[model samples]
Target: MGSAWTQSFREELSVGKVKFSLSQPELLLQPQWSISPLAWLLYRLFMLLYTFIWCLYSALLFSSPKWLLFLSHIVYCSMAMYYLLALCNLVWAAIQVRNFYRNAAANQNEGSRVRGGSVGPFPLPPLLSAALRLQWCLHNLVSSFSVTVTLLYWMLVYPIEKHPLSTFNINMHVGNSVQALLDLVLSSTPIHLAHYVHLFLAACLYILFLLLYWLSGGTSLSRKPYIYKVLDFGRWPLVAAFSVIGFICIGLPLGHFLLLVPLKV
Candidate 1:
């Protein structure tokens, strides 16, 4: 019976014929405080605007004429992409909430709860719903990345005390890291182990990009093919292996901790 049900579900999903329904509005998954659809839409838009501004500011700081310069480094690319995905997810969520309410209003008998698989918010089609669920997961990983970057640069790579003359750099570093960490703390999204794949793939892609840049003869101000000294290709196999392991150690624990955050009822 389980196998038959699973097969039917898969077939329904393949044809986009599946519909999901939930009995209660409060049962919906949300990160942080739930607000009106308009408020949610505005919140996402505000974040999108901030992300755009930050990218421009970062570009100016680098003062590089080539657009590829930003793409070459994982920091800007990954972080920016994260914000973009968040913005998209917010839009989808807003739509879902709007649809939910509209359906509820139409069906005066249903109270505040969602019903039927017809066209309500709650149980979205499996694929799109799954994608929506990923938003917070990616957010957590990106937040982890932000924290990791700050710690790695400030504590392990170069302490602010050593670079006292570069106070502006310190401000940027602290601002970015603090904001990311705060966002994670404020969110109400639940973490899932399956979503760890997204984090892993993100890291792998960045490493691949760096290697490709090196192979293509990209160089920094110091004429090294790699942007960070820790990634210096000259050190080869050992450096590469250690860097990967080190990131996993930092990321996995951080992700697990986010999952462990106590949820407010």
Candidate 2:
């Protein structure tokens, strides 16, 4: 069984005959379970509202001095953007549905047969297509980033911290993961095993940010030279490098695999 499962996972990672599509807008709009699209839309809207409001609260809490240092804030911002894109995808879908029905009605009035399985003149509009692509990319990004941020924070940063965590900190770390998991379970969004590349790329980008910050003499809110103690490149360069490499190579793929299990259900 282990061998077979490993083989199956390997097949997913195969680059041969790989294909991706954004032509089916329904797959983007509809839920995996038998639920109304409106329900999904409403859920997305609520998430957007929550994340947006909390982002504002976090801004106030940090008060701009330390806002840019934390990875939590960056991931939270990405989550907000993901939810916003999701909401826009739904609204665009609704518009297409309405137009489709209106066109059908007009055709019926003219005594012409309406074509079935057509939504707003077939091939989706260019703008909607672009939006769906962006939404898909962000979905993959947030899934990995949220889980990584939560695990890293709780395991590495929280344990050695001298101060107790605030509600905002807890929400940013724990709640973000919950939101991402709920999105995975509740929606029809597809997760491709090979898409772990997105996570790896994001990890690399963050490492670059750390290097730049170090070079620029940026500090944490506590006025420490590094953002997080574990990631303090200047103080413990080897350890920090290994931590990033491990996350990019192991942590990201593991998180993506966990997400895939839910989708397979």
Candidate 3:
């Protein structure tokens, strides 16, 4: 039993293997079940627009001077980028479809001249292929990271920070997770077990940024040494370290697993 379970775990990780792909762009752009691709496209467009408007509003509300300090803003930007890339992928898919039909018609004409000759479907352009892979990675990263940020914000940051519940606050914290959950459920994007590494790396990068910011005596807009009191590594290194570990090691994987449940169902 132990050996069998170990093998199953190994297969789940698919270690040393390239788990991502640029082929079958439909898998990234289309819906999972019978929902129309047009519907999915429109939904993605709506999300893109919604996130953009709020992001612009946020920029104006907070102003440009303090935009870089907050992790919430970073995650919001990531969310916006994810949707934007998704829209681009949909456009690419549409172009690929049109090209496929055009190629087929041309091949049919050529086949009459040279009987039994045919051509395969159109291949993705090199640039679009790379963009699809980026979209896939962002899909995994944003899905897990948005949920983690939401959980940490409401559970940890809200109480002590004592920030009043406002529209922007709710939108950034709660609405981001809602969007992620909807995307996970509605989209056909596949999530791999090892993809959680993206979230882990992002967490590590933020931790490094925190250390550097502290070392350089950087401060939040409020002029606090740390970005968030929970992540105040300078004052409470152990707490911050454990928080990062818990989110990256525990929260992120669990969130990814939960997101997988919808796909599996």
TM-score of each: 0.64, 0.89, 0.89
Of candidate 1, the 10-residue stretch with the lowest lDDT total is 18-27
Q: What is the C-alpha RMSD of each candidate to the true structure, in Å?
A: 8.7, 2.6, 2.7
Please list the residue runs of candidate 1 whose C-alpha ends up more than 4 Å from where it truly belongs after superposition.
1-31, 34-42, 65-77, 99-131, 159-168, 193-195, 235-241, 250-265
Task: Evaluate all candidate structures by whole-model CA lDDT and list the values in order.
Answer: 0.56, 0.80, 0.80
Q: How well is each residue in 128-227 modelled by candidate 2, as lDDT tens digits?
A: 8888878888888898788888877787778867446778877988998899998888877777888876677787888898889888998888788988
Instruction: Compute the lDDT for candidate 3.
Output: 0.80
- Runs in model 2 deviating more than 4 A are 1-7, 16-20, 111-121
Assess candidate 2 and give its lDDT: 0.80
Backbone collision tally, model 1: 2
lDDT of 1 by residue, 33-149 (tens): 666656655665676676567667656766774434422234444556666766666666557767876766677566434345354335555555665445554565666566666
Residue 79 in candidate 2 has what lDDT?
A: 88
For model 2 the local lDDT of residue 221 reads 82
Q: Candidate 3 lDDT, tens digit per residue, 1-265? A: 7787677557667864236765566688778778876787788999999999998898898776567667778888888999999998788778887987686778688664424554555677788878888999888888887887787787888988988889988998999889999888788787867776777788789878878988999888788888888788878988888887887788777777777655534
Write the number of the candidate with greater lDDT, choosing between 1 and 2. Answer: 2
